[model samples]
Target: MDKSLEKSLTLWLKQQQTVCAGYLKLTVLFGILTGLCLLAQAYTLASVLDGLIMQQLSLLTFYPELIALLSLTIFRALLAYAKESSGFIAGKKLRAQVRQTVLNKLISLGPSFINTKPAGTWANIVLEQIEDLHDFYAKYLPAMMLAGFIPLIILAAIVPINWLSAMILLVTAPLIPLFMVLVGMGAAEANRKNFSALQQLNGHFLDSLRGLRTLILFHRQQAEIDKIANVSNDVKQRTMSVLSLAFLSSAVLEFFAAISIAILAVYFGFSFLGHLEWGSFSLLPPTEHRLSLFSGLFVLLLAPEFYQPLKDLGTHYHAKAKAIGAAESLVTLLNIQDSSLTSHITTSLIASSKASHTKIDLKTWELEANNLKVFTHDGECLLGPISFTISGQQKLAVVGASGSGKTTLVNLLLGFLPYEGSLKIQGIEFNQLDLSHWRNNLAWLGQEPQLFHGTLMDNLRLGNQTLSTEKAWELLAKANIDDFVSQHPLGLKLSIGEQAAGISVGQAQRIALARALSRDANVFILDEPTASLDSASADAITQSLTKETTAKCLLIVTHKLSQLGAMDTILVLEKGQLNSSGSYDELMAQNGLFCQLNAQTAYDIDLQTSLGLNS
Candidate 1:
């Protein structure tokens, strides 16, 4: 195994105390019963042979030996069943516990961190890799412990009767496991690569499926199919290579084990035939002789069974390698540190510390930014060194072209990422405030609203679960979606597909707006919430928002030139730099870019409206 994989495996095993100990005990007990059964079978065979050789073959005379063999077989089967059942229980419970722990990590990591990871990778970790632990727990690990302990038991049982046979068996048995360790390591590496390829293929397939419409529009469907086919072929080739390695390793182990057992059989047979050292105890067979022969034969029979566990272990090694690769990725994802303005939650996972610190020194009501800087992952600066403030329930409109860092600014304030320089709310340092509590005091509606797999009411309940159905209808009435939701046969029970596939984009936006309103947060950030709605719907939403019931701060980011008139203050951003800031007339009076841009926007809107081209 790779060093990292070995370390992780060690960590995983150490943590599973009760489960591992239970499995170990059960396995040993089963192995003991199985070894005893082999002993009984060998002794009965020798006793019956000696009786027949001496012309004393009678079923009634050998009744005791037959009964002993039958009892041992029955007990061994019962013990084996118990071992399997206990293993199943342990595997199930451990999978559940580990799964819950992983989920908790995902939840605590929050959306920002999760967004950075691929959905396919997350699916593989949670669904596939965690499930792979079952094979190791239920099958391979038990057999490994048995492999080590059973050989010693067999050697001890035969040592007194025939030391030469015991020596041969004991000396050569370790060769199988040793050879496995050296040759099977390659299979582990190949299996890890296969799993990674599989994950990439899955990710590519899902992404293509999601963007199938875009592919058809661009006439790239056949190209995508060919690309996926190539990935499939690569996966198949890698899988076959890994399985071939497993097969070769098993064959090697079988050959070594069979040869070792054959050598032991030769030594025992020679001694019994008076061609080798006929010790005083060994020379007493044939009705009164060969007592030692019975024990040696029994040890010989069990020697192969002992090595069979090792062969099975070789196969599981391949499965376990794939599982470990998936697990390593999962551990990294689950342990991703949430280092933003949001509060950090620490846990005893990964090697990282759980320390929560805050930037203190600002008050909670005064908004100010000093020398702020934000950079993208690729090292391109989005915003920087810009200072501004919004105080006392003020409404500010942020306007700019599409790529001028408008959304990036909102992300900064939402505490999704870290920034340089100082940002304060009410003079309280933005980082010092408890982020979860701070977020609870804010509500946001982005250009695209996210809806999960649930009913409209069920999704809405995420905002305020205590709200009654009657109250929900009232909120929907305000957002102008009451009729649409009510018209459905199931009404509140009407199910939405994943990502709100059943709803139009406009309706999804309305539901998001309703969700924000339900929170009743002190600060509301609307990032072009009306971007997708129809004219009448947009007008109704803007009107409803304007009639605010509470004194709350509002910041709206929009490219809707017509909506500029509604803002108490309008701010313009150009090339990530704030160019103009003031009330509508105040900026337009200066007649800078803001005035020129507004004029061009109005002219275009008028033309589109006249030509019946605006959607």
Candidate 2:
């Protein structure tokens, strides 16, 4: 084996000591079985050969050897079956355990970690890489160890009969492994590259699929196809390179093993033809007696089996490398720190001595954002150094341009992201309040609602797992979606296609709104909650939202200028800073961006009507 390859394998094995040790024990047991089975099979062959050479081939006389050989063969098959079953089970157990550990960590890390990572890459890690470890842990590793050990045991047994034969086997045994290691080193590198390329391809494919509609609208369908093809081609080339390396490694190992066995055969044939004799050591002869002849033939029979494991072992190493590459990515992702401000918040619902300064009752929940400023990882500023407060039974509207950091501010308040300043509940700093308790008080409706593939009832019930059918129907009614949903033959039991496909955009939003209402939170943060609706639908939703806000702290983000008039307080944001905070009349009096933007919308409507463009 090349020195560098040997070093790499040793280092890799050491890092995986605990998991590898379990496989080692299994391999040891398998090795013992293999040795015993081979010895019995060879002994039976020797007995049959001895009888045949003497012209005494009687079934009755050879009955004991025949029966013993039959029993060993049966035992060997049983042992092999047990080993395979147990190894597969162990691999499965390890995969599940590792995947579970990573999943728990990812959940704690939450949205921030997810935002930074490509969803496709995470999916590949959890699904593909985790599954590949099965072959390496269950089959290849154990076989490799057994292959190495069994040969030595066979050599020990055969050495006393003919030192020359034993020497040849011992010396040639190293050659197969040496060739395997040299070839396998190149394969490992290729495998790592292939695995990386495959993950990138997956990420690109997912990204393209998610934006297919947008791409088609821009007349970029052909361009998207070209992009996908590029990624596919890269993956294909890497895969073929790895396969080629594996083929070459297998060929080299097989050739060496065959050549070594042929040389031994030649030596044995020459010795027999020349009538060679040993002048010394009656116990160890250069020429074969009946026992030596039987042992040599048996050794020859077992020779190929000794090298077969090494070949199989080298092939499995690629699977191990691929698994490790995936595992490494997952581990890094799971190691991400919970950088969210919510991490400091307690998870309990009940207010205690820690929350006393907030002056909130155990059942009361109020939220306040105090001069909170958020920045991206690259230090691009998001939300304000502006203060805001929303006490019970108040509705606040945050109006801004497309990129004016409205979502960032809401996320900060929700404790999904860390902030520069502080947020408090009922006058207490947000960090002191229980995050889980705080979350329980909220019903958030994002512009794009994510409805997982399932029945409508299934998706709705995800809001509160214990929600009764009666409660769900009531929520659907309140969200104004009950009429549309009930008209379908399947009603609440209808299965929504993946990500709520086969449903209107407005319906999807309302379904999510229904889920949020079903939770019965004391707080609601709606981001463009009426964006997908027509004027009449928007009016109905606004009325429902306004009624729901009577006893809760409501924070809605919108670009719809007319909705600002209904809010108790209208907070206008511009260039990542809060511009105005007051009633609509007060903001209009200031004649700032809010007034100008509203005026522009009014003019556009009037112009469209004059040109007969209004719907």
Candidate 3:
């Protein structure tokens, strides 16, 4: 591989070693002990064979050596078991740590980072990419050290018996690694491209699945299938390339190992035939330098052992390449620094702010802003240079067309996105307060409520799980879904699909409302809550929204302009700027954006109804 990549991989491995030092030390210790056991077994077996063949000693006479061999074999087995079990634990711990690090980094990057990629791309990075590093930790890293040390131990045992064979083994060992480096360069690059292709294919397939209905309606299903197939073919080619290089590297190592072992055997054969006097350690006359059966057998036995560690090194070489490929992405992700904040306004500064020092928890919760602005990653403004104030238990509606930044306002309030300009809560800077603490006091319900696979009771208890069953039932009654839930045979224990199965979207939204009520939050922000509901459901929800915030501060973002008549204030946004702000009648009297949106609702409702009927 290139120097830069090699250095990066080395650095990353060293960092991992530091994180998992105890386990890796255990691995190396077990590995070296296993090598010692192998030597004992080999030496004992050779001694027994020599005793039988040359001295004509009885098999029964070799009992002690045989027992020693059996004992080493059992100990080796136990060592192997411990190595494997410990390696698994180490890999699990590393994977969990890496996954959590990625999750935390993603959170620090916020929703903008999430919006930049497809769900499957993130899935491939978070799940498959992290999982691919398991072997790197469990095997490749420890094997790297063992591969160098174990062979030296075997060579030390052999040099006294047959220095020539040890010399041959040492000379040939570098060729395997030299060839490996050459082969591994291509394999590393191929593996990286393969992972990228797989991620793209997954992302494309996921996007297609999410938009399947639209594609079907437009008669583009066959086209999508063909595109997916092409991406699959690309992945197949990339995978084959990686495998070919890996196989080639393994073959090269095996060939060199086989040659070294054969050379050792040949030298022992010639020495026994009196063809050479200098091959063995004894340097007397030709007859004196002759091979002793035990000496020759032991040297031959050591040949494979000398080459075995090198052979293992070849196996782990591919793992190193794979890890290097994975590390490139990991390094890039970890290096991301949020550019939105100014040079002095660090994330740590914002995070360390105390909420308890402020009067934000007062009964009269007040929010004041002065020219708040939000920007996309590319520096394009998405919201603001607009200002507003909200106080007491008031219901307010923010209305705008698509891309006008209505949702951005709520995102700012929820602390999902950062903003410029002063936003104060109870006369204290909002950014100076602990956001996680701030968020707990404010309830947010989005366009869709994420209901997991669980009992109805489990889903409903989401907002305030500490509530008693009877108390939870009361909140459900307030949400107007208690009657339907009570009539169901399974009652609170009714099983539901994750995708709002066995219940309508309206019911899911109601369950979300009930969850909000259970929390008994002082502030509630609803983002297009009834956007997906039918007219009857929508009207019912609109009516519910009016009554839902009797003693709570409610902020609503909706295109349903009719519902804003009872709202304390109606804020109109046009192209990220605040166009108007007043009650519904006041805006109508001004003949501003509110009246224009009111005029468009007639067509919107008609178009929606027609589309609904057609579908």
Candidate 4:
């Protein structure tokens, strides 16, 4: 019923032919061959019946006719196999291409794009929804063509023998497809709702699984179960509705096909009884009053075969309905990047650390932002108008209250969003730099270590395999994870869990720190690196990073506000604007937010006192 959904489906169907027409054409060829074979079988069977019954010929004399029928059946069977195999290959290739396009689109859009939708919805798009389109490509699309042509072939064979029967078959044929279109509209809508309900239910289930321990701790597991049950019931009802429409369409098709066949049968029967002769076509020099037994039997035999393609199409049409439902959602997701609202990217995703300083250009390691502003899709500025410049191996800390644009600024620096003003890196416009290469030159460590399931050494290299074992071991000692590694039998070869599941959170942060240090990066962006740990563990991580900061320009976005003795400059941000920029001593004298934050500092500020600012 939705015009937009119907329009999108039409456009999407047109796209499939261009992408895999070579494979899909084979499905059409085999389907037509099978139709020809069906007509041949009818003719052979009718001839054999006529010879034995009307001509009084012995079965042995008509053995060739019998053999022809058997051969046609065998040939049709082989064509059926080729048809099915070709259809499968067509669907498989199309799905592979669709999935690859989806993946590449997602990659270009990155995490900011992905986080907007439910994980389960994305999984459904990538897995279930694209997969649901197989039937459309493999069965429904081919059937669409065969249904049109195959019936015409049957009509061609029938018209010379009995035009009235062919007329009855042709006129009633449109009714099945006409009514099917009406039912299919409802089926498509129901399937869409069913897929939506499935996505929601799956998302809720995965969330519940992830939070099961917390749910049990709060004694809400049973309530969660009840909620899931209600959603599951919605999915069940939607599924039944779709099946009900499919059955209704089939019932309508069968009813019309039976009525059409019966009309032909009754005409042939009355003529045989010499009660009617008006409907029978005259094929001889003298007009025939009644039909011969052979002609009548042949037409009767081809009756079911006449409506067969339409019936086959009616069955496969459900696949079209299902694919329409899935394609509608997938089209929206696939078009996200092309949408005007999301495509403006202004900053570089990569940058060389300010201190590296080897490029030929002036201020090659400098970063400058003048009146820079970043607005979200909804037009609200998350970071703005604040400008700063950094050069040399300057260690700076950005301190702000919650919602003071710390995360937004980090994203802007990392080139996740578009900016409205001037941004320069290493004397080059930030927008002109290669983001991937710039990212390779910098190191980033977050609060929770991003550990995948692999050897400890692999996690340490962080996808760059050029780091030597000796360098990795040195970083391990610096981060205080060497003690644990030495105690373990595998050392760096020890397997870590996905997201550091096998290791404690404290130990995980240490490994992340070690990994960051091993990169020998020129600029390190450490964001809330100690947020999850206790005072002792936090102090240990802070101590480990301070010793490794001399050669690199380190930017820390932190709430700790402690140990400022080692910081060269700390910029205090209030809301989205810069409030103050000073050293620990200057800020303490200025009595700004930095001073108040330092006043509340709970960690031992002198824990890493020896690693003071050198520049």
Q: For residues 237-283, could you state the per-residue lDDT of candidate 2 as single tens digits?
A: 99888778778877887788889889877776665565544311236
Q: Pairing residues by index, what is the TM-score of model 1?
A: 0.82
Candidate 1 lDDT by residue in tens digits, 377-460: 223457766888887567788988878778878876776555666777756666566566666677888777888999888889
TM-score for every candidate vs. truth? 0.82, 0.82, 0.89, 0.87
Residue 610 Cα positional deviation in candidate 4, in Å, after optimal superposition: 25
Write candidate 4's Cα lDDT for 262-312 as tens digits.
888888888889997765566732356678777788788888887878888
Per-model RMSD to reference: 4.8, 5.4, 3.6, 5.3
The models' CA-based lDDT, in order, is 0.71, 0.71, 0.79, 0.77
Model 3, span 503-547: residue lDDT tens? 877788878877776776788898888776666666767777678
* Full candidate order by TM-score, most accurate first: 3, 4, 1, 2
Q: lDDT of candidate 4 vs native? A: 0.77
Off by over 4 Å in 4: 278-289, 340-364, 377-380, 392-394, 426-432, 466-471, 518-523, 534-553, 563-569, 603-615
Question: Ten-residue segment with the worst summed lDDT in candidate 1?
Answer: 344-353
How good is model 4 by TM-score? Answer: 0.87
Candidate number that wins on TM-score, 1 or 3: 3
Superposed model 2: Cα runs more than 4 Å off: 1-24, 54-59, 111-120, 206-223, 274-291, 338-362, 365-394, 413-415, 418-441, 565-571, 578-589, 596-615
